[model samples]
Structure formats: structure tokens, C-alpha cells
Target chain A: SAVISQKPSRDICQRGTSLTIQCQVDSQVTMMFWYRQQPGQSLTLIATANQGSEATYESGFVIDKFPISRPNLTFSTLTVSNMSPEDSSIYLCSVGVGLNTEAFFGQGTRLTVV
Target chain B: GIQVEQSPPDLILQEGANSTLRCNFSDSVNNLQWFHQNPWGQLINLFYIPSGTKQNGRLSATTVATERYSLLYISSSQTTDSGVYFCAVGGNGNQFYFGTGTSLTVIP
Candidate 1:
């Protein structure tokens, strides 16, 4: 299991503003992912952050809205751009150590857009 | 893409009671994981049972890969188990598709 730490555990941001959440892993990992969970709802994947490259996004998410950066194997960031009330949700980072392996998630950053 | 479904959508149990949570997938998978998200919002990995059975403490999980379904059994439940239980699966890649989750409330 990997230890993942996310910064700014919770934040209050105004609409139109953006927030960047950082995720730091205890050790090097091959793949990193970002997910979103609305208030009282299931999680929805936002993208797969690759080390030293662009992130792969899900169906309803795009880079313009959720820009990701994975500068190294142990660090990644997800920035929610142009925030809206609908964008208010808990953002989580996860990683898988191997093929057919279990994934571990961060405690999650709770964002409230007003 | 794989679809994961979990049921019953909501469950209420008494402390020290036992219950079962089921997860169904739309297709064959190489990965199946169970997670418990506590009230404070910490997602903890419980089991990664793609097939067969696994146990840890008072919790155990069984996965029948051929049937595309898995079961999580919680024995001697505690209030600490009150939260949402999510089951996720991956078909070809490591990326998982998650279910809506079973919101379990264990009341004392």
C-alpha cells in the first residue's frame, strides 16, 4: 500500500476562481489518477495523471477544465479551472502499484465553490 | 468500459449484527476492489478479491469472476463501519470503473 497525502484538505473558493490540489505519494508509482465525488454521491473519475506527460481524462471531463500535472513519479496535481457551484465536490488521488492490483486513495480534498 | 453496480442501495444494521454487500459487474474483469469510505471521508481499501475469497479481521470478501459478481461480508459490525461501501472493477487496464456504492449505517 502507498501513502498519499493531499494538501488543503478543504477549501472555500469563489465561482470563476480555480484551485490546484496537490498529491504526494510516499514512493514512486507508475500511474496516478484523479476522481471527483459530489456531495452525497458516488465518485466520478476525472483523469489519469501520467508522470512527465499529459493526463488522460474521462468522458465528461477535459484538460481545459481540469488541468493535471505529474512532474515526477511521486507527485501530481489537479487544478480545477473556472470553478462553479456544480464543481464543488471532494477530489481524490489514487494509484495502482501493479497489474490487477488494488488501488489506494488519498483522504480527498473537499472543495466548495460559492 | 465496465459498469459496476452495488446493492442494496441503502442498508441499516444493528451493531454486532452481520450483513452482506454485493457487487455486480457488466463484463469480465482482471481487477475487483472493495473500499470503505468512512464518515470523515477516508477511503480505505478492504479487499482486492478478483476471484476466490479473502479475509481480514472481521471482514471477508468472495469474488466469483466467472459470474461477474463479488460479495463482502461484515461480521460483528461496529459503528465505525457506518459509511459507503464501493466496489470497483477494471477489465483490460488498471483503471477502475466504480459502482454507486452501498451506504451502510450501523446503528447502536
Candidate 2:
């Protein structure tokens, strides 16, 4: 089992500002994923961060808007840039031990744009 | 991309009542899980039944991969069980697609 710890449980940010959320895992992992859950919506995958390579983003999401960094196997960061009111949502990070394994999630960072 | 649809978008149950949640997937999946998101927005993993049945305490889940659906059963509900339940499925890729969650409100 993997234990993920995400920082900044909740943050209220001004528009046009950027916030970087960090995720740390208890153990080393090969792949870490970033997700966004808009108000009253289900979670949507933002990107997959693999150490030593560029994060692969999902459609409708781009690298410039949500840049990701994976400095090592146990840590990753996601930055929401040029934020807008529409960007107000809960961002979460996840990690799975391996194939066919149950995935674990962080407590999630709630961002409110004002 | 796979489509995951969950039934009973919202539910209100009395304490000690029992309820069942359903999750339907559009394609075959390699992983399926049930999670409960508390009011604080913390997602707690409940089950990881990809192709079989798993029970933990008052909560149980069954996944029929061939039928392309899964079910989560909560027996003897309590006020603490009031939260949003989500079902997530993963296909061949590493990404997991989440279903439209079922918001459950349990009252005493």
C-alpha cells in the first residue's frame, strides 16, 4: 500500500496567481497522477507524472496551464498557472503500488479562486 | 475513453437503513474501486474489487467484469456513512476514470 501526503489542505488564491501543490509518497513509485474535481463534479485526470520524463496530460488540459514536476520517485508537484474562477476546484494526487493494485490518494488540496 | 455511469445520483437514508449503489462501465476494465469522500473532501478507499466480491465490515462490493458493472452495498448505515461515494475504473492505461458520484445523506 502507498501513503500519499499532499500539502496545503486548502487555499484561497487571487485570480491570475499560481499555486503549486506538492505530493509526497511514503515509498518509491514509478507513476504518479494528478486529478482535478471541480465543484460538485467527479474527478478528472489532469496528467501522469513519471520521474525523469515530461508529464503526459489528458485532453482539454495542457502543460502550460498545469505544469507538473517529478523530481524523484517519491515526490511530485503540480502548478496551476494563471488561475481563474473556473479553476477553483479540489486537486488530488494518487499513486498505485503496481499493476492490478489498489490506488491510494492524498487528502486533496481545495483551491478557491476569488 | 471509457464511460462510467453510477445510479441514484443522490440518496438519503435513515440511520440503520441499508442501501445499494450501482456502477456501470462502458468497457472492460482492469481495475475498479469504491471510495467514500467525507465532508472534509478526504477520499477513503473502501474496496478494490476488480472482478470479484470483497467485504470489509458493514460495506461490501461486487464486480462482474463480464457484465461491465459493479455494485456497492452498505448495511446498517450510520450517520457517519453520510458522504459522497465514488466508483473509479481503470482500463489498459494507467489512468482511472471516475463515475458520477452518489451523494448520500444519512439522518438519525
**Which parts of model 1 are misplaced by more than 4 Å?**
none
Q: Give the best candidate by DockQ.
A: 1
Q: List the residue pairs that clash in candidate 1.
A: none
Candidate 2 runs further than 4 Å off: none
Displacement of residue B31 (Cα, Å) in model 1 is: 0.8
DockQ of 1: 0.75
lDDT of each: 0.92, 0.94
User: What docking class should model 1 receive?
Assistant: medium
Could you tell me the lDDT of residue B106 within candidate 2?
98
Question: Which 10 consecutive positions of candidate 2 chain B have the poorest summed lDDT?
Answer: B88-97
User: Taking chain A of candidate 1, what TM-score results?
Assistant: 0.98
**How far does residue B35 in candidate 2 sit from its true spot (Å)?**
0.2
> What TM-score, over all chains together, does every model reach?
0.97, 0.98
lDDT of 2 by residue, B1-108 (tens): 889999899999999999999999999999999999999889999998889899999999999999999999999999999999999999764578999999999999
Best candidate, lDDT-wise? 2
Per-residue lDDT tens digits for candidate 1, residues A7-56, read: 98999999999999999999988889999999999888889998777899
TM-score of decoy 1: 0.97
